[model samples]
Target: MSGTFSALNAATTALWAQRRALDVAGQNIANVNTEGYSRQRADMQAIGGSAVPAFYSTSDGIGGGVSVEQVTRIRDAFLEGRGHTEHANYARLSTEAGALEQVETAFREPGDQGIQSLLADVWDGWEAVTNGPDTDATRAQVLQQMEALVGGLHFASASLKAQWNQTRENLTVLVDDVNAAAASIADLNQAIQRGNQTSLPVNSLVDQRDLLVMKLADQAGASVRHGKDGMVDVIVGGVTLVGGTSATKLAVAGSLDLAGTGTSPVRVVTAVGGHTVRPDGTAAGQLAAMNGIFPSYQSDLDALAKDFADAVNGVHTTGAYDKLGNPGIDVFESADGSPINASNIRVAFDDPALIAASGLPGAANTDSSKADEIAQLRSKAGGPDATYRRLVVQLGVEAAVANRGVQIQQVITTQIDASRESVAGVNLDEEMTNMLSYQHAYAAAGRLVSTIDEMLDVLINRTGRVGL
Candidate 1:
């Protein structure tokens, strides 16, 4: 009777264990398509021998049936860490490539309507004046072309400023995103810690936390450190952004400027520690576009404008006389006393008669020497045209480099992501196979329980009745 009872007890335990395993399999199947879900496995172990003396035990002493030890999530911490690092790198490069492409669009190069073409027209106007220096139509054309040149400078300068402002705005928005993600991660950390205390399965919470951390990395190139009790710490630029259940927010400080100097260029800094965070991910890309790349182009444009105006005005003021028989005054002046940069340059002469096309006061109206001299300035080495061409070529090279960087990082990032998915991502086919396996085990265990019940009935009722 004792042996039969022990057998029935073992069979019952097997049934419950198998049922739990089936439940685990069903859970896995349900969340198979969920993002960031790590597959879970039920750990089963055979129960050990009983405390009964060997002499008193049955000859076929297999002890007890199976018992579930623990159900654990399947994940490799090393692989996940590697994936996060690669994700950050890929995001930074991608952001930089996108911003550089926008800067390229602002230039409007290789087209007729660009500043380069307008400069060429300015030179052509000078050449026309050389053919008919005294003609009112010729002088009017020169004046009109000069005004158009100035307008082009203003347009290009304004466009660059707009791009800078837009980049700063994007940085502010990204900073907000970074802060939100940090706070969410901190909240998840607290929840996960609570789950750990209660011995509850917190794999879902961990998945959500990881997803948020990845997003934060994209925004700010954050570093993650896993701790005991399922907590994770996030850091950016050597400053801790999230620790345990506490999160530090990021703030944008300063203004956007073209000089690349002053605290005017916006910066990302930790709110608690007041540590200045260097540009890392998308924020780094935006800052580079606003303070570094765009400003450089702006500076070049200003320099070109100043040099072109100086060159033309130098020749006009010193070498020619106006139709009023007065020596030429400066044909271009700074709107303010500051250097004649692109934004503030204007034509100094308002009267068409004041344009000095004749080399001498008493010279014939057709004395085109001064006009010829001005036209020849276009072909000078390192002049405005050459300088402008060099600037364009530099921009093209920078854009190409940025694009190539994005492509290379993308391939590397893809490979790392695939590796992570293999280890952590759920596969429906594998889950289905596991489901079938668990079902068969469950069925076998149920049969054992039924067999044990039948045998117990025989021992209890049939054995005593056979002799009666």
Candidate 2:
């Protein structure tokens, strides 16, 4: 009688275990399209008979039943860690490539309306003036061309400055995002810890936290360290952004504008101690563009502006004279009389009569030597034209390199993500197969229950009625 009851109990346990496994498969199928969800598995353990012997107790050495041991997510810790690192690298490269492309658009190199074309027009204007030194119309054309060149320089400088300021603003926003993610991670950490202590399911909570951790990795190059009780520490540049249930806030400090960057460079730092964080992801790329790339281009433009002004002014004020044969003054000056740069380079006087087109004093209307000399500057080995060409070439090469880096990093990131997905991502076909297996096992367990019940009925009712 005891053995027959034990058989029934074993069948009941099988039914329950199979039902739990089916439920897990169903959960996986339901979340097939859900982001950051890991596939779950229900582990089963066989229940054994008691080891101690007792009088009148039969021993068959057979298992009593099957039971669910635990439910766990199928995840690879090493793959997840690698995924975060590759994501950071991809974000940085993409950001830098985007910034470089923007800069290239601003320059408009090799195009009709670009600075190169404007510079060519200026040299042509000088040649026109050399052909008719006494002609006010030709001299006025020279002034217009110079104005165009100066305007081009100003536009280029302004674009760089604007991009720099925008990138700075973006950094502040990125820092805010990082802080928000850290706070959310800390909150989730506390919840997971509490759930773990009470032996409650915390898989969903862990998934949410992992997504936020990846966000931090992309935004700030944060890394994670697992801790006890289902908690994780988020670190950036060796500083913990989130430790257990506590989060550290971050701040952006220093330059607000590109003009001020020289004196006060931009930095990402901890909100409390002002410790700098040199991040490795998107923030790092923006910092590189703002602090190094944009500024270098601006400086190159400034150098070109100053050099062009100095060369033209030296020729114009020394040996040349205006139409009235008076000693020529400076032809280009800043509005504030400061040194000319890309931002403030302008024609000092608008009147064509003030232009010194003559090579000799008192022969202003006749001599074209000065105008010819200025026109010849276009072919000078180390002239403004050469400098501007060099800047354009450098920009093109850098932009190309940045774009290439983005492509390669993108390939790597995609491959890592694919590997991670294979490990943790749900598969509908596999889940359907598992569902069928669980269904058949459940049916078998039910059949066993029915058979055991029939046997018990025969022993209790039919056996006593035999031969009555």
Among all candidates shown, the one with the greatest TM-score: 2
For residues 247-318, could you state the per-residue lDDT of candidate 2 as single tens digits? 999999988888777888898999999999889899988988888888888888889999999988998888
TM-score of 1: 0.93
Candidate 2: pairs in clash: none
Instruction: Give the TM-scores of the predictions, in the order they appear.
Output: 0.93, 0.97
Clashes of 2: 0
Q: Write the per-residue lDDT of candidate 1 for residues 135-156, one digit (tens) a residue.
A: 7788888888889888888888
| 10 residues in a row with least lDDT, candidate 1 | 256-265
RMSD of 1: 2.4
